[model samples]
Target: MLIRDYAEIFPEWVKLAKVACVIPVSSVPAERGFSLQNRIKTAQRSRLGEGRVTRRMHIASSRDTLDTFDFNSAAARFTAAKYRKK
Candidate 1:
């Protein structure tokens, strides 16, 4: 559908009929998953361990809505708790 929408902009070598728009649609879900992973690894929390990072990332990515996750507040609390022990 996307290819058909932007057929004009596509390279001339790509035959319109032969062009398959399968990747983008399939990748959107994976892209969203990666986006959730990135949000968990922002500048402030870049030093987080892989195990904890992956656990939080999985939860954040699987949820239907990010609003319910409250990652920012949780991350802040986590940071505070860790720092208090230092």
Candidate 2:
């Protein structure tokens, strides 16, 4: 019933709703943590203890900066600095 009358009775509301949109955000960091765990616990190194594995995983994930680290620029800058020091 509500669905059928949504456009007729709530015409203004529908128009306002149509003009706006919604988006969902999520924590990609948490997903990266799980991925790190799997990679760390692979066949050859499956004997790792839970606590040590969790700590290592957390450190690795936390170091993954979303911005601020540009590998190419950093490498160029490092090379330039080293060359100047000579």
Candidate 3:
């Protein structure tokens, strides 16, 4: 609000403030991602490739919304794809 009110008088400062505002205020998000990766890549599953790990991470992160997703359609598409492994 202060930045918007004095934007005209402090154009450069306002620009700096806008950029600073986008900078993360904490490292918790990054730490959480790393922690999730650690949990997904346990010693027993350490051989999993990067692509598989990434897909697992995406699934784990979005698990909260899985109930609303169309799993039937996704399953159909997966089975209909010719390139998919048996």
Give the CA lDDT, 0 to 100, for residue 19 in model 3. Answer: 92
- Show the colliding residue pairs in model 1: none
Off by over 4 Å in 2: 1-27, 64-86
Question: For model 3, how does the per-residue alpha-carbon lDDT over 27-82 read when each residue is reduced to its tens digit?
Answer: 99999999999999999999999999999999899866767989999889988885
TM-score on alpha carbons, each prediction: 0.40, 0.38, 0.66
Q: Which ten residues in a row have the lowest lDDT in candidate 1?
A: 16-25
Tens digit of lDDT per residue, candidate 1, span 1-86?
53467567765635644645333546777887788888888899989999989899876657657666678888999999999999
| Candidate closest to the true structure, highest lDDT | 3
lDDT of 3: 0.91
RMSD of each: 12.2, 10.5, 3.5
State the lDDT of candidate 2 residue by residue for 1-86, as single tens digits.
34356988888777766565343267686787778899988898889899989888876766768576689987999999999999
- lDDT, candidate 2, at 14: 74
Ranking by TM-score: 3, 1, 2
Better of 1 and 2 by lDDT: 2
Q: By TM-score, who's the top model here?
A: 3
lDDT (CA) for every model shown?
A: 0.75, 0.78, 0.91
Clashing pairs in 3: none
